[model samples]
Target: MNTSRRTFLKQSSFALAGVSLLSNRLFAAAAASNEITGIQLYSVRDDMKKDPSGTLKQLADMGYKYVEHANYVNGKFYGYAPVDFKKLLDDLGLKMYSGHTVMNKQDWDEAKNDFTDKWKQTVADAAIVGQQYVISPWLDESMRNNMSDFKRYMDVFNKCGELCKKSGMKFGYHNHNFEFSTKLDGVRLYDLILKNTDPDLVAQQLDMGNMYEAGGIAMDVVKQYPGRFELMHVKDEIKSKNPGEMGGGYESTVLGKGVIPVKEVIDYGRNKGGTTQFIIEQESYQDKTPLECAKEDLRIMKGWGY
Candidate 1:
């Protein structure tokens, strides 16, 4: 989004466009593996920025076998090249199953009828890091405010799914509070997303806690869209002391310590919503260290039989 980054991507477009795609069969085998419980690295953003290797080692030591990344910049994950980062995780006994990278309009080249080189490199890097899914965590406001544009972007989302499919990966969208609160033509934006995208290609990763502030109930949503969500952001929310942290008077807390029916909802997500990956993510620690919160969340999830 920045000027420098844009220029860099343009300069590297040709080289990255040629990156090879992985085999669909290999990706299918990976997808067929047992369910996973992972942590989103963004929960410890400061620590990762300071010492990615040390932070990862600590997570592995805490019984975390899998992780989902929230940081990727200029074709690198946490400052490490994709292959090198994969090796680091391999050595630490961890696997990165998914990651967040916002795929905005800039990533698409309408003139070429294809993705820009930068996005292609992003997918290439994700494959190199052995990820099953490449998720975009945010939707730009321009795409949301207009009905015609929103529908067009939804089409683009499906096209992205097609691109990811060729590389043995699935393109996924992660939701936030806006999707639940914002509506167009009397239809909720979230519903439009679910309706527009093809299920086989575009997987959904629902953030359970995010929708609460916007009056969206996790239980109802899962029941409404049975067998739609393939992944879930396992989080709990409590009334925030400081309001408006996430455009609502709520912030994430450690699992089982907040108002969310953590157990019941995830149970439904697994049994009825088709969720296979339960990823722990707590954004606010309430005086506890981020790592401490991370440890407790994992313990709680395991106790619940995840």
Candidate 2:
């Protein structure tokens, strides 16, 4: 083992003696609280298209206890009826803790009456599948590239958060690289959105790897806005040693092989804020098959001794 890996293991053994390791496929006895290690389904989207049900079962077998969904185009969740999907998930011993489906203001305006209707239906589906969060993952073109856009965007966010609150679900935002690079009114657009939105009304699904890629420090964001980030994406970025500008126009690497400060960020998120889950997302694979890449990631996390 490398020196860092050995050091990490030694420390974990000394300090986190009873904590279950996330590396191995074995279940930690201390997971009495039902804590989860989830995967963003987007990682295996192609495989899912080929065989959604079978792929889900395979993911469970591969040690992913939970999943965050990506493809719920219409009222239906994952192309199947919600009830049916729920049963399938239950049979697989998996829980859909969150989803990345977006709803825009125009969508709500044209179907304003349908707003509550659609919202109710989505929340009902979440309940059916045991999902706790429904996240808006992107900013439309109109909401980007300028200052005025962010101001308007915050209003929409607050409104959506209120709607989600009333429906017994949490509303969250999942960011991409643009939110970091794009400036709004001399300040970062992300800062404006977080400041303007009600903390209780809106939460953040802080993609730690992407946040680092966006030129924002993950620990700093969490420190500045405590409790707002209930969920976190735990991926690593392989830094380009050449020292060009990092983030925004950035590239991703396999988990645990990036320049991103993985341990410090997770430690900060877990101890400093309300971090609910540390999700693993692998987007880069230059040398291996998808399954090989995922298995390597699992092995790396296991090596971390957590």
lDDT values for all models: 0.91, 0.72
Cα deviation at 252, candidate 1, in Å, is 0.8
Specify the highest-lDDT model's number.
Answer: 1
* TM-score of every prediction relative to native: 0.89, 0.79
Quote the positional error of residue 260 for candidate 1 in Å. 0.9
With candidate 2 superimposed using the best TM-score fit, by how many Å does residue 192's alpha carbon deviate from the native?
0.7
Clashing pairs in 1: none
Could you give the C-alpha RMSD of every candidate to the true structure, in order shown? 16.1, 10.0
Off by over 4 Å in 1: 1-33
**Per-residue lDDT tens digits of candidate 1, residues 135-220?**
99998899999899999999889999999998999999999999999999999999999999999989999999989999889999
The parts of candidate 2 lying over 4 Å away from their true place are 1-34, 110-120, 145-149, 239-249, 302-306
Residue 40, model 2: Cα distance from true site in angstroms: 0.3
lDDT of 2 by residue, 1-306 (tens): 457988989997876655544422233333314455677877777777788998888787777678888887667766888888888888998888888887665545534533556665766676677777778888786876676666666777777777777667777888776778777667887887788878788778888777676678887888888867778877776655443234344445677566777777766666557675667776655566655666666566556543
Residue range with the least summed lDDT across 10 consecutive positions in model 1? 19-28
